[model samples]
Target chain A: MSKEKIRELKKKIEALVIAIPRELEAYEFYLDLAEKSADDAPSKEMFMFLAKQELFHRDHLEKMMNDLQSQLEEELKKGK
Target chain B: MLPLKKLIVHTHHIATHFTNALFPVSAALITLYLITDKPSFETACYYSMIFGLMSIPVAYGSGFYDWRTRFQGRRTFIFDHKVVFGIIFLILASIVVIWRSYDGGIMYSVGLNKWLYVTLVYSLTGIATWLGYLGGKFI
Candidate 1:
């Protein structure tokens, strides 16, 4: 691949990495909402349900980052 | 830097909007139950509640799982919003269960407890909505 293409891929990987932290924050937010509703049964169940999704997204992103790192390393090796 | 900033700006703007929508979606589902007074509505609420609660539990679990399995330490942050929001949702859920029980079939019976639960549902929904705002900032 050309230098330009490799550089663009690197930028994309970096952006994906940055996004992981925000996803974590969103997950925590759902958790907080669920906790607050513990006094009420209905809301508690719902919030907990939604909170799990946030965690799923976080896991999804983390996996994406790991994959990206491996891909970047492989590409660099090809350039050698 | 400039393009990244623009992307973040756009993303935040969209997230705030999406989070805001959760309130009305939940409220509308609840209102449908209140208005129609049917068992189906009750089922709908049940589904929503179940889905909502799963989000938090799964998120926390996955976060820990990632940390332990990946050996990466990038999932910690300001947790005030999470703690408060979790408590609020729990309180609301309790009120909902009681309200569900209060009514014979679906809608609440004409009683003091009905009114009390209604008031709580409204209050807790408001809290949930605000927490969405805080979440948007962090996201």
Candidate 2:
């Protein structure tokens, strides 16, 4: 790929890396909400479910970040 | 006339809670599959969808009964909103599951853009969350 294409891919990877923390924050928020709602069975169950979903989102984003990083490394190697 | 005491403690309560709970699981599984491109995650997503679909009828049946008996035929705006969104959520979720199944039970592997499938599942999750929020008003 050309230098321009490589630069764009790097930028996109950087954005994805930055998003990882935000997903973690969401996970924490949902988990905390789930804990607080423990007295209310239905509400607690709902929040717990959301928390699990957020955890999955965080894990998935982490995997995506790793994949993008690998792709970025490949592009950089080609550019070099 | 349905007894007020029974309406307060309907068996459907468990079904509705289980149904609402499964929505998040479905959303999470799909999100995991989208990011990791894992076949296992995709399979889990399919299973979650199937479970969610199974729970819907029980949840809806009980919820409808409660609405009719407890609310006394008065359709409040909030209740109507919940009903409408609930139906929409069901349709959207069904489409996602059916599409994924017909596409060979793999989302990213399908010919269609992966992001589009991810977006569809995300929207379904958002709709389910909204429905839960509306339902919370009753509590």
Candidate 3:
């Protein structure tokens, strides 16, 4: 629980905080494309696929944030 | 100030799309390379797999995040299926990348390994489609 270690953990959590919504937005953007391309089967399928990937990315980021939070808590508890 | 998860999720829409797009593209490229026996298509397929393999962690990470926050880390059937298949997808993609990298002539060789290599590459698309379908269920 050194200061630098704590700082590094904080930085990662901060980055994940910034990333979560962007991932969600990407999910929505691809979903919109899928909807718009309904007439073209291939295009629609590709767009829908892309949208799912974005959702997956958002979920991944949230997991990272949770991990960081847990690590920080452990560090803080050790320090005290 | 907006909370991190509350901010617009539209930002940084780059690498994951490339990651998501490239697997299927690689599958298609390999299909053509098999049919035409074109070196260029095979090379393209190799590069696509490399890039696609690189971006998987990002997609995997973000998907885990969504599951935790949206679903409260609940162990539902779809999420469980996604987790299992997603890991398989990751492992399979890694195998193909390593297999091809170690032996660049894999596809050209005439053997079970070559067909397995090709079959694994094609399965990346199948897994991606399945993963996508699971993600759709979440929506």
- Candidate with maximal lDDT: 3
RMSD, one per candidate, in order: 19.8, 19.9, 14.6
Model 2 agreement with the true structure over B1-139: per-residue lDDT tens digits:
5455465436567776776777678778877776787788878877777788788887787778766664534444566787898888788778877877787644655555566777777787787778777766555
Clashing pairs in 2: none
Residues A1-80 of candidate 2 have per-residue lDDT tens digits of 57887667666655554455556557767777888988898988888788788778878877886786788678778877
Q: Write the per-residue lDDT of candidate 3 for residues B48-71, one digit (tens) a residue.
A: 999988887767776666556645
Q: Which wins on TM-score, candidate 2 or candidate 3? A: 3
The C-alpha stretches of model 3 lying farther than 4 A from their native spots are A1-80, B1-3, B6-17
Query: What would the TM-score be for candidate 2 when compared with the true structure?
Result: 0.56
Candidate 3 structure, TM-score to reference: 0.59
Q: How close is candidate 1 to the true structure, as a TM-score?
A: 0.40
The 10 consecutive residues of candidate 3 chain B with the worst lDDT sum are: B6-15
DockQ of each: 0.03, 0.01, 0.03
Report, to 2 decimal places, the DockQ of model 2: 0.01
Q: What's each prediction's TM-score? A: 0.40, 0.56, 0.59
